[model samples]
Target: MAPELPFDDQEASTNLPLATQIFRFVVTGVGSGILDFGLTAILQYALGMPAGFAKAIGFVCGTTTAYIFNRRWTFRAEPSMARFVAVAVLYCVTFVVNVGVYTYLSHLWPETVLYSLLGYVIAQGLATIINFIVQRTVIFNIK
Candidate 1:
C-alpha cells in the first residue's frame, strides 16, 4: 500500500499552483455566499422576517456550511471543536455587522430588493475577507 500523506501533503497533491488554490478558495467562497443570500432571501420574503433577523439566521447557516466545507475540502485541515467555537464567535461579530447593514439599507431604500441585496453583498464581502484570512492563517493554518 502507498504511504499515507499528511493533510498538508494531500492538499498539495493538486500540484496546480498557488493561483489555483486561491482560485478554488474564491469559488468555494462564492458557493458559501450563495447559501447566505438564498437563506436570507427566503427568510425575508417567505417567512416575512425582518432583514436584520433574516441576515442573522442566514449568517449562522452560511458560516456553518463554510466551516465544514473549508475544513474538509478547501483547506484540508483537521477538525477541532474548540477551533469551531472560536470561528463561530468571530462569525457572530460579522453577523452583527451584517444585520446593521441590512437594517440600514432596508430603511434607506424601503421599496427595492436591490438595496437589500447590495447591503448583503457589502456585509458578506467584508465577512468573507475576514473569514478567509482567519480560517487560512489562524484556524485552519493552511501553511
Candidate 2:
C-alpha cells in the first residue's frame, strides 16, 4: 500500500476567507516581485544581458519563491507531486505570456530604467492575476 500524504485528510474546501487569501497572496507577490525586479535589473543593466533573457530568469526565480510561500502559508497545503506538476504547467503558460508582453513593451519604449520598470510591471501584473486565480480555483483547491 502507498503511504498516506499529509494533506490527504484536508477538507475539500479551502476554509480561509477569499479576502484573507488575496491579502496573503498580495504580500507574497510583493516579496517575489522584489526578487524578480532586482534580478532583472542586475542582469539587464549591470551584466548587459538581453532584456528578455534577464526577465525570463527573474520570472523563474520569482515564481519559485511564490510557489514555496503560496503552498505553505497562503494555501496551507502539504507538498505533493501532482500539485507541483499542475503549477509547473500553469507557470509555463504564464511564462510565455509574461515574456511576450515584456518583449513587446521593450520594443516600443526607449532603453531606459523607466521603460524597463514599466514593462516589468505590466507583464508581472498580468501573470500575477492569472496565477492567483488558477491557484485558488484549481491547483491549490483541496479537492
TM-score against native, each model: 0.78, 0.89
lDDT of each: 0.70, 0.86
- Displacement of residue 66 (Cα, Å) in model 2 is 0.5
lDDT of 1 by residue, 61-127 (tens): 8778777666666666566677777777777777777777777778787645677788888888877
State the local distance difference test value for candidate 1.
Answer: 0.70
Where does candidate 2 stray beyond 4 Å?
Answer: 1-13
lDDT value, residue 101 of candidate 1: 72
Candidate 2 least-lDDT 10 residues: 1-10
Per-residue C-alpha lDDT of model 2 across residues 1-143, encoded as one tens digit per residue: 23223234444335667886788788889999999999999999999999999999999999999898788767767777889899999999999999889989999999788899999999999999999999999999644
Task: Tell me how many residue pairs clash in candidate 2.
Answer: 0
| Number of the top lDDT candidate | 2
How close to the true structure is residue 84 of candidate 1, measured as C-alpha lDDT? 74
Could you tell me which residue pairs clash in candidate 2? none
RMSD from true fold, candidate 2: 6.5
List candidate 1 stretches off by more than 4 Å.
1-18
